[model samples]
Structures are given as C-alpha cells and as structure tokens.
Target chain A: MECKLIRPADLDEALAAREQYTHDALPIAGGQSLLVMMRNRLVAPAALIDLEPIEALRGVEVSSAGISIGAMNTCRQLIASPVLGEEVGVLPVAARQVSSTAVRNLGTIGGNVCHNEPGADLPPALLALNARAAVRRRANAREVPLAEFFTGYFETVLEPDEILCRIDIEHPPAGAAGVYLKHAISPEDLAMVGVAAVVVPDGKQTGGVAEVRIGIGGAAPVPLRAARTEAALKGAVLDAETARAAGETAATEVDPPSDPHAGADYRRKMVSVFVRRALLQAARQIEENGHGAA
Target chain B: MALLELKVNGQEVRVEAPDTALLLDVLRERLALTGAKRGCETSHCGCCTVRVDGMAVHSCVVLAVRCEGKAIATVEGCGDGMELDRLQRLFLEHGAVQCGYCGPGMLMAAQALLEQNPAPTLDEVKKGLDGNLCRCTGYTPIFDAILAYGRGE
Candidate 1:
C-alpha cells in the first residue's frame, strides 16, 4: 500500500487530510479488519489517517435523546463498559459474541458497521436497535439510518471525503428485549446463520405481546427485518407456539445464497431455526425482566 | 512505507516498512525479533498474536504503522532476565508446547487472559484461547496447563 501515516487531532484535520489525498487512503481505527485486509493485499491504501488521536471520537455516552457511541470505541470497550451496558445492554450483549477478547479489544464498532459486512455480529443488533450513523465530510455532518447505510454487498454510503463518526441509538423501545444468536462451526469463525430479534411489548408483560420486531442476518445481502415474521407475531401471545410460528414465517421469506459455510437451503432452514431460537431467547429475557421488576 | 515510532518491550524506536506491512513482519524482520513466529498468515491462528498497549492483537493483521505511539509486548519480552511468565511455565509443565510454532502467541494470549481473570474457569480458559489454532490437537493439554496456572496449582 502506498501510504502516509497521518494522525489528525480533530475531525476537521482528519477531513482535511482526506480531501487532500486520494480515495486510496483509508481512515483507520482499531485496525483489526482493515490491517488484515491490507496485509492480505485485498486493500492497498495510498494513505492511512489514524483515528485514535482524536479524543472526541472515543466514548459511549447516553443522553436524553439516545446513546452516542464514538467511532473509536472498541468492541471490548463496549462489552466491558458498565455505562454503555446499562444504557444499551443490547450492544454489550452483541459485542460479547464478537470473536475472542483479543479481537474484541482491537476491533472497533465503527469499523465493523462501516465495512458493512452482513456476517458481522454487531450490525444485526444495530439494525434491531434502530441505530443511525453520523457521517462527517469536511464541515458537514449527516445522520443515516443503519438500514439505508448498506447499498449492496460490501458497499456503503461512505463518500470519498466522509468518515463514519459515531453511532446514535434512540432509547430502548418500550418493553423491548433484544437477542442475537448465531450458528458458528467453531469459535473465532464467522457465523453460518445469525438472527437478531427485538420485541417491544406494550408495557409490563402484564397482558399479551403487543408489538414485536425481528431482524435476520447471515442469510441475506444485509441484515434484514423479517416483516412477514413480525406481522405474524404482532399482538399474538408471546408463547412457544407464536414464537415458533414467527420463526417458521421468517424461514419462508429469506433468500439465502450458497457459500462454503452452508448451502442456501440449509441457511434458509437455519433462518427458521435461529429465529425460533432468537424469539425464545427474547421471550425468556422479557419474562425474567418482568419477574425481577415484580 | 511510513516512519513510525513506538515502544517495544519498553524502549522507544522508529522504523520504516511498507505501510501495509504487518506488525509481525516489523517485529520479526525489521527489528529482528524472531520470538513471535508466523504460523498462519491469517489472524485466526494466534501464532502471530502480541500484546499492544496492554491488549492482545493479531500482529499478523495489524499494520506496523498503526503500532506507532503504542506499547508492544512480544515473546522476546517474556521470560525477562531468567524466569518465564507463569503461563509459559504452565505450558511447559503440561507439555502444551508440541511443535512449539504456536507457543509465543499462545503464551501471550494466555498471559493477557489470566492477568484479566486470575482464576478463569475451564470454559473461560477455552474461550480465552479460542483465537489460537493448535494443529496438534493439543488444546486439552494447553487448557490443562492454563487451568493449572490459573488456579495456582
């Protein structure tokens, strides 16, 4: 990679360096995936703008509006952070499944989301959280919903001069319980089929399930919200039968591609299987929470 | 290549290599510290793992340029003076060093794991070393070694 090591102290400086350089230059944080791809010669950047020096780009804070996760925040930091954990426990829960502690310590959420890989563990949870990303280009900043961020396979809306600056997640959906489950061949391996489910009940589990939301990943081009499944589960009693039905509904809608990890048919089957697993997981969490509150 | 400055085992220095060159190559070639081996070019194998800024990372996939202004601990930095780190001793006691290609990275990973959780359970031990690939199927012995060390046995 043809390169210059640039450590800009602020967003402006970082943007300035990027504007002066070509698209071949990459904005780097954590370097867990970026450096690996570079070493593998999959990415040859002409320049690398290191993001660690910018202190403002490092933190996990909860405000009245939502939770703001800095771009430089590492996965390990997110997982171990009591502040982020309590503010948005789903993120911490998702972060725990991101490979080993070593990878988590060095891999940043911004990188994972920005890379826009469907198999990544964080994106499904982010999608379920209704997360949005703040992108910066020169003096301008705009927020893009996570669902709209991915344009195609391995592609994102990141402009040449822009960088993913932060992730903003609105307060937890009322009665929302989020769960992410994946089928992996082994530890440290990518998921064969991953599923994330978010259930937003009306209030306490006093009555029946009011509204439930679901997302499925590792079986599509991007993490997907199973509208059919959600429609099937809406207002239904959050019981074994309903949850199982939602899983089966999700399995029918997903169009999986054949990869070395799994065949398309197997992936489709896992969609149903994992959705059932995720829904049951979500239901148990909600039941336990209500029990604890009582 | 880019000129980068960083501390290795506590000393400061500057070096230049292909900006995309991995920290593993920098340590093994540029600085001539052969203690950290390159068993698998991919990060899946912890044979190239190292502690950077007190956290373990796959050096084989981390750019040397990114190592700038960070602290690096390689296998050479272990067993200072005359004594091996507790994890290293445990590996020897349990015969976990078969082929020895993955020894340095395993020890580094284990050291970081045990330091974080002195008394990790058997599951925790397995989880901690999940990044490593022991081709000899020597995982049980390694787990035993780390568990023994973890429990101070």
Candidate 2:
C-alpha cells in the first residue's frame, strides 16, 4: 500500500490533520528516525503529516519568564542560537553531542522528545533545566513537565490527536552551574549512561549547594530525575564524598535494562560513575566562575 | 506518486516518485545521479551523505517530497564535470581512497565542512567526518586530505 503525505501550512492545520488521521498518520519532523523505522518495518503508518512546512514551529523566543523553543528547531539551530547559549548554556552543549553532524543537521528537539528513545541526549538536559512540553490539539492546549512526559521505552504522554509545539524552560537560579556527561563506546552511538546535573550555590555557606537537580538517561525505561538523590544532596556542602554518595543513591533509583551494548550490571555501574563525574564537573564550574556564572 | 521539483547541482529538475521515496533513491535511481552510494539504508553509515541547502545530511533517511524547493547537491556536482576538484586531488595525493567506495560521500562531507570552517583543526576534521566510516583507508589519510585542503596544500 502507498502511504499518503500531507503538508500543512500552519500549526492549526497540522493539528486538524493530526485529529483527522489520529493513529493512522504519524507526524514527521526531520524524519531522521521515523523514516528509518519505516524502512526497517518497525512501523507502518497509512499517512505521514509533514511538519517541515509550518513556520509557526520554527524559532526561539526569550521572555522574562524563560525560554520557549520551537518544536521544529533543529539540533544545528539549537547549537547556533545565541539566546540558548546565554540563557541555558547546557542545552547547546548537549545539542552538540547528539548523534553526528549529518543527523544533527536534520534532527529536531520535538522529534527527539516525542520519540522518547531511552538513550536520547536532550531529555536529561531538558529535565534538569526544568523544561515543560507545550502540546496542542485543535482548540485545546496543555503543558506537561518534562519530568512527567516520558512514560516508558520509546513512549511519551503525547496523544494521537495532539502536537508537541514547544518546549519551555525557566531561567536557571543565580550562580548555578549545569553539566551533561555521556558515556558511550562511540560518539555516534546512544549513550550507555547520560547524566545531567544543575547545581545552585547556597549564598550563606561557601562551597554549599542550596539545591541540585539530576537528570539521568540510558539507565532506565525512561529518562528521569533522581528525586531521592536530589533530596539527600539538598543544602549540603558539595565535596568528593557527597558527590560519590549522591551517585550511589542515583544508581539505586534506576532500573536499567540489559542489551548487547551494555549489561544491566555494567549500565548500573556507569550510572554511578557518570553521575558523580557530572556533579563534580558542575561544582568545578561553580568554583572556577566564583558563583553561578558557569 | 508525486511530482517533485528540486534544484540539484545548480539546475532545476523534476521527477515522478512515491510520496515516501527516499532522497537517496530518487537521486540515484530516478535522477541517475549515482554518485551518492547506497550503503546501510539506515542513517548510520555516511555513504549516502549529500548536501541539502549547504548542510550535510544522510540522504537515505530524507524523503524526496520534503526536499522540494530546496537546493540539493550530490557528489556528482563536486567539480566542473571535466576535471577533479582540489579536494579530490588532495584525497588522491594523501592516499585517502583504497577501494574508492566511500570517496564521493567523503568529498561531499569535506566540502560542506570547509565551506563552514575554511580552517579546521585535526580534531574538528574528525568530528566533521564522524558520520562517515571508511574501513579501507583507516581514516588517517582521509583526515590528512581534509586538513591539507584546509591548509591550502
């Protein structure tokens, strides 16, 4: 059977097309992974709604509240945006490390998130930045916190009739530093363990952190925040011992899967190792810059 | 099948293809521009790399319909069609081609990189070609070729 192609001019029309097709059609953004999946027979859709022609899903907007990133913004565009560079520096850093130059040229943040691949680079960084996904369907709209967006392996909370339009991230706290670490055999491979840490310094105590947010990927069914680990590190002076203990706690929080790339035991160990390294790197960024200047 | 009007190698052309036809297929089979090799229909190998609007993308994963109204440059467009380009000459001088299967894709990728960064460090060259894999030349010669091109050798 031949698959139909629908190109919508605007977001509203895209949403309506999505509503009309529902499960029969899949919206293709960049088509980096979706087309590959179709070729491999992993998925067979009756139609594809091409999201490339919609201008509304294209640029970045900065406001006093935070940054609003368009869903169709390619990884190359994210890496080049000066606004993201100044406001949320870690996003650009993580964006640069996604796949390879060829894939980055066409891959978009919306497709990455909606695809919900376990080892994806963006979710952990976006989660640590406290990002929210703005989803719309016809006349209705809603925003889901990035933390609650992913449901399971290659699954998200997105509905068949809805479209992920934007990702909104609030400004980081003053004097906070963010760092993302990826462990993989090759640069192009999905991370064996991906860790992202955002550290906010406590103004009262030198070398003390008021709060810490840790987002982990490739260690569990979905990219998730290390809540218990974060609670343990809250208001604590960051030292090597504290960082090590936080890594241990973060590793305990995840249920990793075993695959040919990595065994379950190996992935768990890497989770511990990378989380500690990421925190130490983030703290070092604070020490070097004096406050949250990193 | 849909009629696709595309700009390729500095010319406008039209072809009738399936709506979901891959850019690699359209370029190689329909347009007869076989310079972009077909290897690993999956996006892993850069053998199918081509420049769309001056950016290198794995054509195997790109839909031909999506490329309408965009400028697509394949490896066939590398030279003036008579003589080898400077980058191609550098590849030969540096012994970058062994089996010669990955040559065209390498040239397109290197050309895109140089257009963006006229002078690239050795590490930058490696990262620029990370998508491409060459089992024959062990990659050192390819790297040497790109670096030499950057240095105007």
Candidate 3:
C-alpha cells in the first residue's frame, strides 16, 4: 500500500486532514505503534497525517489545575522532565519503566494509551492519577476520563476521525502519593501484571486513608479502575491489614487471561501482591514526606 | 513517492521513495549507508538502531519522511577514516564483538548514552545498552568495554 506522508502544521490542519480522509487517514504521533502494526499488515492507511509537526500537540504544561501533557511528548521526554517527575511521580516513574531506550525515545504517551495495549505501563498510572484524555474532532474537543477511556483490549472510545491531542492529569491531593508497580518477566518486557496506587492522607484523622485509587492492567481485557478495592480502602486506616484486604479484593475483582508468560491464577496472585506493595509504598511516601503532593 | 531530505551522518542527502518507506530501508538501499544493520524489522531487536536528533531509535519503524530536518547518526558516522571511535576501539579491545553483527547498532546506542552521560554508572550503562542484544560475549565484556571507555582508559 503506497501512502502519502502529510505533515500538518497545526491542529487545524490535522483535523482538516482527518475530516477529509476520515478512517482512511491515520494520525502518526510518534509512529512507534502505528508503524509496527503497518509492518505486520494489521493496518495500511492511505495517508499518514504526521502529528509531530503540530506544535500545539507537543509540550508539558503545568498549571494550577493540573499537568496538561501534549500527546506527542515521547516517553524519554516525559521521564526527563523534572516537573512531571516531582508532581506526578507515578507518571515519570511509569515512563521510565517502559521498553528500552530505543523505543522510549520514539514512543509517545498518546500512542501508548491509544494503542491500549493490555500490558502497557502508562495506562494504569494514568488511570490512577484520574487523568483525562483530550480528544478533538475538527472544531470540537472533549475530555474523556482515563478510567472510562479504554473500551476493550486495544480499543478506546475515540472516534475514527478524532485525535488524542493531550492528556490532562489533575494535581494530586495536597497530601497524596502515588506509585506504579509492574511485574514483568524482564525489565523491558510487557507487564505480566501492573498495579498503580494513589493514596491521599486524611487531615482529620492521623494515618487514615482520605482517598484511594487503584488501577490494574494485564489482569483484565482492559486497564480498569479497581472500584471495589478502592471502596474497601477509602475510609480504612493506612495499615498492613487494610492494604491486604484491598489487595485481596482487587485480586477477586480482576479477570486475568492465561497466556504463555503467566497463568490467570498467577496474574491474579501477583495483582494482590503488587497492589499491597504499592499501597504500602505510597503510605510510606506519605509518612516520609508528610503530605503535600510528592 | 516523496522527496525527503535527511541530514544523515552530518550530510544532507536526498532520497526519493514511497512515504511508507522506513528510514532503515532508505538508508541501507538508497543511501548505501549499510552500517545500521537490518535485523528483526520489528522494533524489538536493536540491530537497526540509529540516532535521530541524538536519541537512539529503532530506524526500522521510523518513517523516512518523518526524519526530515533531523540529524541522524549511524555507526558509519561514529569514526573517521583509519581512526576507530573510542567505543569501537574499546569494544575491540574488550572483545565485545564476536560475530560483529550487533556491533554497529550497539556502538550507536552506546555513543548516544555516552554523549548524554559522560560517566554513566555500571547499571546505567547496562540500561543504556539494554535495547541492543548481543547473544555473544555474555554482555560482561561489552559492559567492561563501555565502562573502560567511560573511565577514559
């Protein structure tokens, strides 16, 4: 399939190209996922609307509301940003744990989330942070919560003509800490099971959980929020007993698949282990830092 | 076909190929800069590693047209005539090369790492070179060579 590479100067030009070609034209942010799929003959678009040149879709903007990360920012760039590393440590921490440097240098967070790979590291972290994906269709734009974004394995709610322009991660609560833990066969390999936890300290009660969010990946058809587990941990005190109960609840709630790397049972077990560990670590961070957005 | 201008190895070169053509194919076939080997066309294997804008990337997946107006460095650009670069010399000295197939890509990856961090620790070097897999030499020699080079030995 012979394709024409079109570099759209801005978001308007990109949306125009999308409006013309619709599903026939595919947007290329980092081209990491799309190109691999193209090589496998999974998708052959008539044209590739290159999003790299669109300056509007390539930056990390930190404001009072939260961090608005341009979709085109590579994993390497995300990990290198001190601002992201400090405010939303789970994001940069997750970015650093992605594949090798070669892939990290070219793989964009948007591509990672849009690919919606079950084992990808970014989705769970983004989900834990309660991030919102900014999607644009021509002149209209909307923000979709990351928790509600993934519809299925390798599927998202984004329309064929819409572009995922940026990701907006709300600032962590004044006394919240987050951690992402992925159990993989190798450091560079896809996660067998991934868990991200964000814990907000309760100012009213000492060492009590004010708010807790848990996101799980590779344990289900899609990365999802652990609602039942979060509910179990919300009002509980930050202790081994509460975290253990939350972990067990998460293990029961998830639906893992048996694959060559690991069995469904093993993944379920790991989800519990990692979720417990993540909660403990987040609690430790809260205790050490004593609260304001680490 | 698109007329793409690539600044490869510090030289501006023009190539005419389909927009879908990969940077690896254009570099090896059209430009005849065969230093970046083509192995495991999927991004998993680092045999086709190249530096685009000073960052190591798997060139096989990188679109040729997307590489426009960017500095690309390959193993061919690592050293001058009759002079091996520090990494090349150190790899040779430390027996980091056995079959020599992964040498070019490994060199480019290492070069990018060294340029970024002049004195990377052992774990950092291993992480930097993690993308490039060498089935031979057990990776310890490769580590020794990179560490020795970093020490300016």
Q: On a 0 to 1 DockQ scale, where is model 2?
A: 0.92
The per-model DockQ list reads: 0.64, 0.92, 0.82
In terms of lDDT, which candidate is strongest? 2
Error of 2 at B104 (Å): 1.1
The reply for model 1, stretches above 4 Å from the true place, is A204-207, A291-294, B1-3, B18-21, B81-83
Which sequence of candidate numbers ranks them by DockQ, best first? 2, 3, 1
Local distance difference test scores for all models = 0.80, 0.91, 0.90
Task: Give the candidate number with the greatest TM-score.
Answer: 2
Clashes of 3: 0
Better of 1 and 2 by TM-score: 2
Model 3 agreement with the true structure over A1-294: per-residue lDDT tens digits: 588788788899999999999989888878887898989899888999999889888989999888999999999999999999888888888998898999999999999999998889999999999999999999799999998899998999988889999999888878889899989988898899989998999877666888899889999999999999998787789788888888899999899999999999999999999999999999988888787453
Q: Estimate each model's TM-score.
A: 0.94, 0.99, 0.98
Off by over 4 Å in 3: A204-206, A292-294
Best by DockQ: 2
Better of 1 and 3 by TM-score: 3
Question: How would you encode candidate 2's per-residue C-alpha lDDT over A1-294 as one tens digit per residue?
Answer: 899999898998999999999999999998899998999999999999999999888899999898999999999999999988887888888888899999999999999999988789989999999999999999799999999999999899999999999999998988899898999999888888999989999877666999999999999999999999999999999989999999999989999999999999899999889989988988888888886432
Q: What is the lDDT of residue A249 in candidate 2?
A: 93
